[model samples]
Target: MKWKKLLAATLALGISAVVMAGCGSDKAASNGEKALVIGDTTFNSSNEEPDVNPHNAYAGWACIRYGIGETLIKYSDKMELQPWLATKWENVDEFTWKFTLRDDVTFSSGRKMDAAAVKQCLEHLIANNKRAAQDLKIAAIEANGQELIIKTTEPRPALLNYLGDPYGCIIDVDAGFEQGIVAGTGPYIATDIKTDDHLVLKKNEHYWGGTPKLDKITIRTITDGNTLSSALQSGEVQAAYGMAYESYPLFKNDKYNISQISTSRCFFGKMNFDPDSVCADPAVRQAIAMGIDKENFVAKLLDGNGFPANGVFPAGPAFGGDKVKAEKFDLDGAKKVLEAAGWVDTDGDGIREKNGKKLVIKWLTYPSRQELPLLAESAQATLKEIGMQVEINNTADNNQVVKDTKAWDVYAMANVQAPTGDPEYWFTVFATSNATKNQGKYRSARLDALENQLSREFDPAKRAQLALDMQQVVLDDHAFVFCSFLKMSMISKANVKNYTSHACDYYQVTADLDVE
Candidate 1:
């Protein structure tokens, strides 16, 4: 009843909020102590954030996002590379990179951070983390004093950008994981961690950057959007990470602060290209791409909190956004394309049939990301209008279902297309023929060759154009239907300070974060 009441009454109205369920109050900041609680939707195992251990399968997202870890390199507000743990880096050769580590840095383990510490951490990462090892492609590492040298297996043009990734968070491997936690050079040190529940953190007094603003911080895993909304509204939490777009109106006022920015988090569909699947048909793939109303979906269902995507990347960089052309939402055009390909509703049941088989799209998606299920349901309705039957299989066991390619026609998922602010990440992870996560198994010789060129390319302008060419190859094949780009947002109370949003969407809690 209280949560329902608070949902109707926005925090912008200045409701007398308390100290986050009184969980952090030790006489209510009597000695000028500061505490904060953040409700994050993407902290559970379902989002690949089982713990703060950076080496364990995307847990690095939690490691970096929660201020428990710091990377050697970080991205600026413009997605440009910035010095973090490492001060200055030099591209020594085509296959070698030299990094100058910060001499003043010390891990929470009380160990001095040097080239040896960083070298040990990176070596441990290469051995334990497969994804990081693959992205970094490190052949050998040499350390001398405060300088760290990394020799890649090949010429990695985007090596610096990859280093800015979450997995690049430097941790003290020698400290060991007592409870899936490690010593890091972040503003905060993770003290207590309970999976799917809460993570308690304390300020790192010897933090390298600056004295942390908050003395204590609690990050609560609130997966439900409504509960997260109510928690922040009732002051059960001071801030929220994954607020529903429909709930945006409730916090748009003086009492609340909404930090939002356009990110490369694209929600797209990968058409099943299995020979046995109906989506294997080119007309079906094209129709599927052209039928879904992305513009209306962004404007209405998304509450205008996203951009209608034209390609894998959003509109800004030379490689992504509107650099290339793709199919638009045209129902008539979709129907004509299907009809031309000999798929027609002969039975007049508003369901198309091709040679005795009905054009049924078995859409497989998960609900971990709030907007994904919404996209599936919305596409289901719109696809029906064009004589296509959509059987929705929205489930949490999507990873299991996807293993059987016969089960799905179009597998839709939300992904950060460019987490490292580079075009190669999306293609290498999802589009390349050798990509392990290539959901649709779509392949093109031209695309693979272009990727090879992009990998070795050192010039900035050439790399940008190469990325654009690769996007066109996928679009021409109708392999993936690019839907919309997410506008990442973080909702905080007016009293919270500097808990800002980043374009990279990796850095959240930082030394600047404070509570009034």
Candidate 2:
């Protein structure tokens, strides 16, 4: 009743579009104050973006997303790498790369950005961040005035792409990370940071780039979609990210602009391979793959925002999409697969049983990504029809809970499978045998060997083929189920300028972002 009433009250914008100037009212307040607040769904600690310290966990995402940090390289709309802090770079040898630094950049803490600063930042990152240390085998680094050279422990063909990761945001290590805030060379400087609450930021007056327009910016973590929508409607926030698809209809007026783009962000499930777990059975994994209605889930549940994904990487890059194959939705085929695995509905209670146990999938997921919970519920209903019982454990403590292999049979989560516009990011973090966050404990010897070849191969064509081969290995094993890619949208008031969405989804707030 509350949701329906809220929807009813918010839907009046359709009628207001005729009477008023547009769906939202014209600016009646003074333009002197340029304080802007944005409602974000995944801004909390639960999403691993707890603070603006780039070296701490995944907090670098928050640092980059909110314009508190800048990387040496950034991705363009075409997903190609462009130099940011670095003027130019070149591969010196099989294990060495050198970069020319910009001469005029300074950190928010008033320190000059030189090759020494860059060297200090990366050394601290490789020492603290496990994923960074593994991905970037930086055996040694040499610093000269504006010339910084890096020598990897091995031949890393994709080193530049890995450096563009959110964790690659360069900061002034000497300034220190006090109160989770580092001296960054970005447009904004974080003032206060509270986990699972809100972040306060102010424009960097001495920013090396263009002058920041807004005086103050607040990023409020609104976990609930309804509350985020209501806040935007009530003028509490000038913009909102992660608004529910159902509420998108309320904001599709002349007054609100929805900046949307297709992203490689995917909602996929990793099957646990515990020895005694049912997901250990290859047939059970195959049946579970074919059981979910991915097409309908995207059409109805997702409101046709995105397309059903066939593999880990979407169909944009040479190694993405149809290059690999996954299971299709076929109820009859799924039933046969389950029966062949000795799981049957012996008691005729609709759900299948094996020996004395029921065919129940402990579906573990988190609620921070709105699409994830929706996918879990959607899968629960669809899997039920295919003689499987899904017990969902959707909580914010998912990072801790997923650590226990026995607690979850299938863990559904949202990740940018190709955040760096490279297929290697996905395999190194999840699919590889020694993956940093391989919560499912899935190991494929062939996949590991292929990833080894991919890491050292410098040729783009050969890398693409190796990636294609690696994806097929995991898909054939039914280790991960790729559901649908995300079509992200950022709904903001019409007055907001340059608050556009990026294909990379790494950048949001910038010096150009202003409310006029």
Candidate 3:
């Protein structure tokens, strides 16, 4: 079969490939011709809704709607807070915040969005335990006729960052249930949302912040990286979302035209910290960390879009800690640790033995992300060097791993950060929430205190210091051996320009994209 038809089938079936070509035909929009085309992997939030009304309910889902839904504040690329629906906001006291709303803004439904509207939106989130609702217990959300006042149980410096997320994006109280189309105060409006397919948007004519330059935008969720790269090359879509690193070489020569950002999606193989499991020993965990050659794994397994990680913070301004020194490749060291842990080869076979038990282990991973399976295979090979038998298991369904944690000795997966940069938000994966979290069920009281302190610390400098300290605590404890910080490679046709990505993973659609 021809590649185009093959690609069409794979795209329909969600399979990634390599080698792509096609010249896109320039088509004009129809009478209501204001739409933008965007490409992504998934659109439906965990809530499984095409669109929702209340902001903060769905992080990724909210972002798409929030752009149409205005927020109390906005954050620039430089991470500076700016006013949005709320003209200005200030701290009335350590526990109280006052926001003066902009009376001129109106929802697409022509309903006036005022202090009362903002109060209603915030109250809903506080009432429901939204994940991003970490800082500021939100003691109360009140509207003083014209101004909105919010009181917190304590002072929260990261409040602006949380509100800047899509969940904080405000929408029309009445148009909240409108699905398939996006409606809010953003510069653009979502007109159509197709499940596991595509999304279409147009500039908001009712936008109070002056009209956008482009008239329309469209976004499609194409799972195949090669197909997306081909779409970019073929001009089927102006830009493509996630690309596997192995495909990066195809566009390496083309410079100043195709734009790519070195993003941070850390990947690692997590262990089942079930106290009953052999991997529960920190010494065993460290040995496993030492056995895998991260530098080579990332260089060979990941191509070029990865960085070796020492801890959870992604090695940047947001992450700080006493450098625990990089994990070195030491086959002998791995052997030594295993020996110290009483893993010995008593039989003539090369595999280790401990009280008649073979050092056989199972590693679990999913195909949700393309890189995870390959990473797990490399781990299996690396562990074998120390007389340990390793098995590789790959499943498309993640619930299997969740339901059968005891069956898995090690599980490989990617942990994406929540909208709030706070480490506390991630405890659901580590805390004693039973096995309700992902990765290994590891817990530490020190980690708990550090996470709690960082959340409440309103001072930027102090908060950063605490975050660094928290990373060290995890490092010293060997919590899920840190691997590489994965980068998001965005391939786009030359015509697409000025596209931007947020700190949190979703792509924003607007008039910025144009077909030259």
Candidate 4:
């Protein structure tokens, strides 16, 4: 929480400076009006390439989505898998798949994209991309003419979905690793990068998708919400991504085109399950879950920008089934549950104590999403009414905070659980004993079995059933206190056309985008 005071002061100064600079600038209009400017707060990389490295998980999404890289497969607006760099693919056998590469595709460095290129990219991905390496479990990949034969260790029904992940972005193998800006086959190429400040991309006339409508694009990083809003309002930036929910009303006019797309991401709290942790008790976790007012948090705190989450996956039957619902907010019920579990307010103090220990919880959350810290504060007030003392640590570095298991009991975080449009992805990342992203170290045998079944089961109905069963298992254990599903919003000038939002939060600016 030490960084919060500094962050607030820094943000105030940054906002003031940006607002003054924006009010006096006419850069967007003066630059031939052909350049598209985007303002965003989610750029995590300071590298010159920004997110060109497929191995860097935090920067990979930005690289793939912003046309700096291309994946073999991509998801459609409807969340269906579609061909991108690879023209088409088919299952050769239970464990082997073959893909047909696009002959016309060429990297920015003029390297031809053939079956060999595809194989090299996949090989690099397997070595660097942790998620792809874990999910694919590929035994071998062979390039034969224009066909790529991929043999997995097991029958992976979601192979296409896994390849569609941003981490699976294909790059020019020769220049990708050694250069700052890797050569890609996408419509736009990174011409220049200024780390956290800005990125300049120029059109790739040789792009197989056809030349983009815009000649150039600039992505500027403005972390402060007020600065982003001001930049957009003053026409300093033509578009903005990840704007604060409270700033939506500022763009509710004809001049701006606001696109609100519901994503697979969910904001939730993870309870530490370490044996020595205070939240190790199942009743304590359940009590906290029962005390949270998810509906109110979404409606009031989020300004109805999101839906109350009931499980790891979102609402669709393809990923999240309809079996589970949001947990009811019951303060009295939570207090009774704690009392039955031997946590009682024996002394005059409001907080309950078990044995000689006070019922105090250390809560940790980040401020990047702009909603998590507020959610932490709200939960703190709500839990206190149930004789639980919650101490919140609002830090910018949650990854480091989670490492100290003894210092924190609950951690609020957000993730697109089913980014690949498959439930198995969520299970592998959160439910399994060896899950890399499972900071809480939650493990369940039943959930593991269900996840295994879900992975191989290709039948739609059967997969849905397995997904529902897995949700129930996690809900029963109270592994996560489900909060809300994110509805990401992007605001742009009215002239900016074809700027669509994807369910997975994958694609952003594409070849079809243009400014009137």
Candidate 5:
């Protein structure tokens, strides 16, 4: 189950390659016009189109829809919010807010955009609790002709952050959200879509702002690392999607340039914390954490593509970066803890036991990530030395992992976390109230208090102190074993002059990239 080896073995170039070039045409009509083709790792969401309403989990859909849609606010790389569809916003009171909508915006379907349309769109996403609904605290929204007013249950200073989410981008309501082809106000319009294949988008010439440089852009889906690498080499696709850290070294050819981007995404292992689960014991969780040397795991197992994670948040925020002194590996210490916890086999059966119970647990993972299963294998070998019975179970689909919350003993996979850097999100994930709640029903009070303190205290000095204190609690509790912070890499042709990437591996096709 070594993913690095398996991926490298299954590597092969994909489908008949197709290339198109016309750099010399229409130079005078548009200032910096160029068409670029890109490849993504998985098929984009079909139903989660962002242009209609909102779907937070939409992958390429979020970004692409952002280009074709509009938002009241947009986020800069600095994490600052800037005006987009809204001209100005006013905080009428601690819980009341108002936004003056821009009068010039229009949807792709030739419908004029207004406050009512925007309000409706936000309401749709808020109604569907599974998507962008939970992230916000909106109590009510009403459109006063050209002005939009919002009321929240609490004074949310981070309200701007929610609006800046790519999912919060606005869409047209004239086109039924559930039945629309594509209705948005962004710079581009999706002209055609081939499920699990490619999305063809053409620049909206009648856009409020001047038309984009590129007349057309096509995003093709290529899940195989080798296929994407070949696509970039053959010029079938000018850019490859997110490349694995291990796969980056192989693409060191002079023909293509590599770019590193920053994102809030990090890969970590969440141990089952329910009392009914075998991983509930702090000793067992600590043993599992200490068993695998994360530093070596990153270097040898991950081919040096990531850094060992000391906390849930990747190094930088107030709450992350510094590793807890106690969480450091002490293999002898782990053996002692397990022994003291009665996890020793008295029956000489090769497995540890306590009160006639065998120490056995299942480690669950998915196939999308070519790393977790391999890590599981290595973990099994490491834990076996402690006389623990460990089994790696490759779970099918994310739903199966969710279902296991009610039936299985353990689960391990990539969990996409919000980037706000607030510990409350973690508390919500692990608190009892959140169990069977979005975070898999894992509950811990220590984790909750740490998160609560991090949320309201926005000052840098205070926030940093809280983050450090909370990180210590997280390490002690072992609700999750912080693993590694991934480094996002991408391969594009040398001539792909303006192609770029974000740390989270998302791309902004219009502003950040272009081609000569």
Candidate 6:
């Protein structure tokens, strides 16, 4: 996890390599005009294609981020919930809620976004989208004139927050699912999709928010961070997202504008708690936690771009409470813990062993974000110094690799912990026993209880206390090595106006975005 500094050294050369590789070209015009091109590193056509289904978490968010979709509620630039589609909502009971839809809203396909449409979309998502199905726990969605009544399986005080998630976007079900085309209520309509390459979107003339300034938008997929930066520099792209921290220097000139927003995203290593897993032992997990220097990792590796994490959540009121602080880095303490746990370097091969079994750990990661593999490599080097054998696997298919490989002990990944501005979402997705994203299989009764309390508590003060309690429990158990809070950066041409970054890391491009 400490590779940010080392990676910075090669940024110049990386950008040069991309420029030399012929990544730059003349700005492609659309309909006899310059189309605003956005280059992003996180665009994956395999999961995003076929209408950018809101059922898939990442793709759903991408659709919302790129202004191809809209949710019932949305977070403003100040991280406050604001009305988008549904003007207002009221809680009828502990499990029942009602939302009032905007009568003027219409899908790009000319379908009115009525209560019936919202109900159909919610029902489809609850039945098909695994994350939505689990998070919402909706028992029924009924259309009542211009309002929609939702009944959940349990008390959901943060139901509006959950509904504001990207997956809750209302789409023209007939057009999106049946025809495999994105017909949304946003300001843009997806016109063409070329898998793994680019997606073309046209301004929605029927948009309730009025016509967008740009007539056309081309979202180009450039997975490499350096190439994304080079594209912006070469005038091929008007804006670039997921830019490497090192590449910011390239846009320091007044001609370019850089927006860095600190988000709830945390880069961390998840330790598997399965009985046979090497990281199953608390001592081993603690040793691994202590082995990595998170302070230095954030300060030096990330070039002071990120905040060092102490607990599971990042620094914020909605998620990070007053109870969290950075864990002390103690390399000597780590060695002592391993030794006390009966692991020692018996063969003098620099790797600890117990009962003739070498203490080797398989670290799994992906390269979609250029920093992950580098972080894994850095963790490998640090763990090796602590007399642990670390094998790194930087694969494209992390899900398949994790499913097939039984040797994986640690998985380095990054996630927006509070995507919904609630701690319940993060805890339910990554900490609960039955969580789909909890690939590590970490389970704790106390943590689960705290999560349940957080979900049901309506009082802001009580909810914040419950969230902090959960963070303390996870920190005490050493569930994972919390690294740093990500600072999402967007580099764009100076003329790109109304392009602001949000803390949730969800909304990027909006109808307001325009070139001056």
Best-performing candidate as measured by TM-score: 2
lDDT of 4 at 480: 83
Stretches > 4 Å off in candidate 5: 1-35, 42-53, 56-66, 178-182, 323-326, 346-350, 406-410, 415-418, 421-432, 435-439, 449-465, 504-507
Screening candidate 5 with a backbone cut-off below 3 angstroms (N, C-alpha, C), the clashing residue pairs are: 68-186, 261-503, 262-503, 263-503, 263-504, 319-467, 435-441, 436-441
After superposition, the stretches of candidate 1 with alpha carbons farther than 4 Å from their true spots are 1-33
Candidate 4 lDDT, tens digit per residue, 1-516? Answer: 222332333344333333333432323334353577788876644211245566665566777768878888888767888888888898988799999988888887677888888788888878876767999889999998788999999888888888888778787777644324567778887755555676667677788888888776777888677888888988888888878888899899999898878887788888899987778988899899999888888998899999988777776657664467546789999998999999999996899989888999899887667788789988999999999899999876666778888878998887887888777888787777777678888889898888778778778789878888888888888888888898978898888887777788867878988887
The residue-by-residue lDDT of candidate 5 on 175-243, one tens digit each, is 644312346787776654545566556567778877676666666766565666666666667776655
What TM-score goes with each of the models? Answer: 0.92, 0.94, 0.82, 0.91, 0.82, 0.91
TM-score of 2: 0.94
lDDT of 2 by residue, 1-516 (tens): 322332244334322222221123223223343667788999877788878888999999999999989998899977899999988999999999999989999888788899998999999999999999999999999999999999999999999999999999989887777667777899987766668877777688889997898876778888999988888988777898888887999999998999999888898999999987789889889998998899998999889988898988888665568878899999899999998889999999999999888999999999878878889999998889889999999999999998999899999998888888788988999989899989889999999999999999999989988988988999999999999998988999989888888888988999998887
Error of 2 at 136 (Å): 0.6
Candidate 4: which stretches are off by over 4 Å? 1-33, 45-50, 178-180
- Relative to the true structure, candidate 1 reaches a TM of 0.92
lDDT tens readout by residue for model 3, 1-516: 221332233342221111111224322344334333445543433223344344433533534532556567765543457787788888877777888888888765566778787777667656653454554468788887559888877776667666765666676554554443334677765555555555555566767877776665556656566676666555666665565666667766543144544444567666677876667877677778788878887888888667777766566665542244545678899899889989899986888887777877777766546677788878888889888788777765554554576777777767654444554444434442232354467777887777667757777788777766766666676666767777655665555565656555443554355555
Q: What is the lDDT of residue 418 in candidate 3?
A: 40
The residue-by-residue lDDT of candidate 6 on 1-516, one tens digit each, is 112332344344333333322333333342253357788777774233334668765578767887888999998655678888999988999999988989999887777889998888888888887878888989988997789999999998888888888888888776654223467888887665545666666678778998787766677778787778777888878888877777777898999888888887888888888788888888889899888877777776677878878787766566663357545777788899999999999889999998888999889987667677767876787888889888988876676666643758998887888888777887787788878778888889998887877778899889988888888887778887788888887888988877778888777777787876
Model 1, range 267-386, lDDT digits (tens) per residue? 999988899899999999999999999998899989999989999898875456698999989999999999999999998999999989999999998776777888998899888998
**Superposed model 2: Cα runs more than 4 Å off:** 1-32
